[model samples]
Target: MFKLLLRRFFSLTLPLALICAAGFGLDWSALALADQAPPGAQIFELHCAGCHIHGGNIVRRNKTLKLKALQRNGMDNLTAISEIVLNGKGNMSAYQDRLTEAEIQSVAAYVLEQAEQGWK
Candidate 1:
């Protein structure tokens, strides 16, 4: 009867639709992650680049990542930078909720590396 046919159609199509949607969602997430630059580079571009272009602080002219500035401000290490990113010290905004912990770690490392290398 039509009732049986309707049940069969629903049973068959509903699971198929769910499976397809799940697959599509996973694929989209993977693609989105892949499209981003490396964790640190991507995070920097998204959050830090506007003000700290090339590791120079736009808001605080004396607070550049140029080795001396970092040492002077006690921000010459990943721990300090990560703390800043999380807590939002001075002119910077907090990214604790906006980014994952892994991302914070990555960008912190990146900042240290860039500073050590003179931002080249």
Candidate 2:
């Protein structure tokens, strides 16, 4: 009876300990780095330029939201941009499901950089 109880306790506790360790490892990985844009500008062209003109698509109806405009609107920072992409505003759709969190962070960084440097 003693051996059986000890075996059962070890079996349950070992799995629980392993599970807790795995969860901590995953959480650390998730928090490891600040999201940055990918190496190329394709993400901006494909996902952002439709409504924002600085990346090069011509504006049709919506206001030409370039880096300058974003700055003027007080949204020319990476964090703001990321939040906007993830949560969306007005006619824009949330991109949390479409793009990875890292991708969104990268694009936001790119846009903020351009805004700060005057889009030259």
Candidate 3:
């Protein structure tokens, strides 16, 4: 009976400790990488990469980050992008709760900058 209890304790506690450590480690890595780039780029990667890979929207054929497309949609500026990000339009979900105001600003700034650079 003593051996059984010891085995059970180790089996549960060991995995639990490992899982906690991994979660903390991942968070630390995210913070470190976030500092390496312009704040917006990092935030964009975390939130937008799934759909807007390389500034090309997979979900929308016409709504891309290319200069001409953005200009056509009136999304070539920070304010426009911020509004879309905050309120979400069409298929995109709103990030108002998921990201802070500063983060949304950063992403908006980043998108415009990247667009000017032609997404290089």
RMSD to the hidden true structure, all candidates = 8.8, 12.4, 6.2
Candidate 3 Cα outliers beyond 4 Å, as residue runs = 1-35
Once fitted onto the true fold, the runs of candidate 1 whose alpha carbons sit more than 4 angstroms away are 1-36
Give the least accurate 10-residue stretch of model 1, judged by summed lDDT: 26-35
lDDT of 2 by residue, 66-99 (tens): 6666766567677888898889876667999989
Q: Which prediction has more favorable lDDT, 2 or 3?
A: 3
Per-residue accuracy of model 1 over 4-54 as CA lDDT, tens digit each: 999999999999998998986756667677676577977888899899999
- The most accurate candidate by TM-score is 3
Per-residue lDDT of candidate 3, residues 62-87 (tens digit): 99987789999999999999999999
Candidate 3's C-alpha lDDT? 0.91
Rank list by TM-score: 3, 1, 2
> Which one is best on lDDT?
3
User: lDDT of each prediction vs. the true structure?
Assistant: 0.88, 0.70, 0.91
Q: What are the per-model numbers of colliding residue pairs?
A: 0, 2, 0
Residue 109, candidate 3: alpha-carbon lDDT: 94
